[model samples]
Target: MITRLGLIKTSLIDYPGKVAAVLFTAGCNFYCPYCHNPELVSGPVPEDFLSMEDILRFLEKRRPVLGGVVITGGEPLLHPDIGVLTGAIRDLGLEIKIDTNGSFPAKLEQLRPDFVAMDIKTSFSNYSRVLPSGTAAEQIVRKIRESLKILIGNGIPHQLRTTIVPGIVAEEDFDMIIPEVRGADSYLLSGYRNQRTLDSSWAEVDPYPAEVLEGIAEKLRLAGVPAQIRTN
Candidate 1:
C-alpha cells in the first residue's frame, strides 16, 4: 500500500510542457519549517487516501488525456515502495516526474524517472539550520551532493529548485548554490508561502518581495545560470 495521501486530478504546471496528475506521497525525512505539506510530512495519512489500485484505475482512464504523472510529497523518495508506484505509472505509458527533497540519491539513480525536480533547501553551510536539529548533517550534505551528481551524470531531464523564505534563504544564499548547480539543466526559485507551513511560527514570516525574487533571478541569469522564478 503505497500511501497516496493527496491527489490533484489534473495540473498544467507540474510536468513542464505536459499536462499531468499530481500524486502526493506521505512522510519526509527532513523537517524544514517552510514545508507546506505538513499533513503529508508527519501527520496521519488522510482517510481518503487512494489505494494503488484506485490510482492505477484512474490513470488507465485518463491516460488518453494526460501526458504524465508528477509524484510529489512530503518527499516521494521517502517511500520504500516508490519504485513500485513509479513502475506502475510507467506501465500505463505515461511519463513520470518525481519531486524529491534531494536526500535519496541512490534510489533516484536506480529508479530513473523521466524527470526529477529536487529542492536545494539552503546552502551547504547553513544546512543544519533548515534540517532537523541533531540530524547527521554531514551525511545529509553528502546525499544532496550525490543526488546532484547523479542527476547531472545521468542527464536526467530535471530542475533544481529553491524556495526563498525571507529569513531562511536570502539573496546571498543564491551565490553559494549557483556555483554548485552551474551549467545544470535549469534552476528555479520559488517564493515561500507561509499560509500553511509546517511550523506555526513560519506562518508569521513574510515572504520575499516580488522584486527581490526577480532581482535574484536576473542576477543568476546574468551569471550564466539558467535561472527562473516559477510563478506556479
Candidate 2:
C-alpha cells in the first residue's frame, strides 16, 4: 500500500505555474544526510496516516480549486501501489507531478506524469555515500542512468535537481554530473537547509551562498545545460 503521510492542501511553489495540492508519501531508498523530511524516510507510518481512500476523497472535494497534484516523498516511486494513486488523481482531471530519486527506472517508465523532478544527489561515482552500506552503488547508478534516458527519450517535462550540501556535493562534482544530464530539459540547483536533516551532524554544515550557486548554474548554462537556481 502507498502510505499517505502528510498533505499540503495548497501550494503555489511546489508545482510550476499551478496552484496544487502536495501529497507526501513514506519510505526512501537513499539516506541523504541533509534530507529535511527525515521522519518520512523510514520507520512505521504514523497511526494517523491517511488511507488511500481518504486522500482521494479530499482531492475530490478540492478539485474545483486545484490545478494539479504533486506527489512527493520519501520517494513516492518506492511505493508499489504508486501507479494506482496517480491513476486515481488523473481521473480527477488534475495534472500529476512526481518527485523522485530516479532509483527505480523500470517503475518510472511505467507511469506518465505531467512533470518529474529527479534529484541527482551527486555524481554517480559517489552515490555510495548516500545509499545504504549493503546497496550495490554501481547497479543503482546504472538504474539512475537508465531512468535519465527514459525521461529524455520519452520527451518528459522534467528537471534534474541537486541540493548544494556543504560537503556532500562540491562544484567539481558537477563536471561528472553534466555528462549524465547534458540533454536534460532543465537542471535545478537548490540551496540546502541545515535544519531537521536525516543526520543531525548535517545541521552543523553550512550551505553554499546564493552567489556560489549562481556561479555554478552559470557554469552549467555555459556547458549547454539549461540551469536555474531555486531559492526556496
Candidate 3:
C-alpha cells in the first residue's frame, strides 16, 4: 500500500461537481521551486505518515455521503501500489480522480481514472528547470507528451494545469503549451502561492495578478483551447 501522507475528510472543490475525500500520497520526481506542499514533495517523515488501513476504514464509513475520492500527491504515479489503492476505492462504488505531473504515461494509461488533472509546468523545452539535474529532459518531455495523447485519444475527462510562476512560466510559454493541450477538455491556469514552497527563494517571489491570468486564459480560449483561470 502507498503511504497515506494526509487526508481531508470532505472537500467540495477537489473533485469537480462532487463532495469528495482527498488523499495525498508522498514523494515526487519533479522539484518545482514553487511547489506548495514541500513536505509531501520531499517524502513524509515516518511519524507523520498515516496507515492505509486506517484511511480505508474512514472512507468506508463515509462512503454513503462521499461521491468520489481524489488521489493526489507530490506525484501519485510514483507509487507502485497505486493501482491497488484506486481499485479498492472503486470497489466502494465511489469515482476516482487523480492529479499527476505527467511523468508516468504508461502507469497513467493503466489507471483509467474517472478524471485526471495533469500539470503542464511549462513548455516541453523548459522542463529542465524543474526536473533534477542530470535528468533526461528529452525523454521525460516525450513521456509527458505521450500522457497528453493518451488523455485526449482515450476520450478521458481530464484537464491540463499550469501554475503561473513569474520566472518559470511566461505568456510566451503558453504559445508552446497551447498546441499540446488543444484537444484537452480544459486548460486551467492556476496562480502561484508563495507559501511553503519547495525552494525558499521562491517564497519571496510575487505571483502574477489575477487579471494577468485572466488575459492569458482569454488568449487561450481565442486560440480554441478551453481555458479558465483558477485563483489560489
lDDT of 2 by residue, 1-232 (tens): 7855578889999888899999999889998988998888889886667888898999999999999999998989988899999999999999999999999988888997999999999888899988987999999999999999999889989988999887788898988888888888999899988977998988999878888898889989988999999866
TM-score for candidate 2: 0.96
Q: Which ten-residue region of model 3 has the weakest summed lDDT?
A: 41-50
6: Cα error in model 2, Å: 1.4
Q: Scored by CA lDDT, what does every candidate get?
A: 0.87, 0.89, 0.89
What would the TM-scores of all predictions be?
A: 0.96, 0.96, 0.96
Candidate 2 minimal-lDDT segment of 10 residues: 1-10
Residue clash pairs of candidate 2: none
Alpha carbon lDDT of residue 214, candidate 1?
95
Alpha carbon lDDT at 7, candidate 1: 79
Model 3 lDDT per residue over 104-188, tens place: 9999999999999999998889999889878999999999999999999999899888899999988888888888888789888
Clashes (candidate 1)? 0
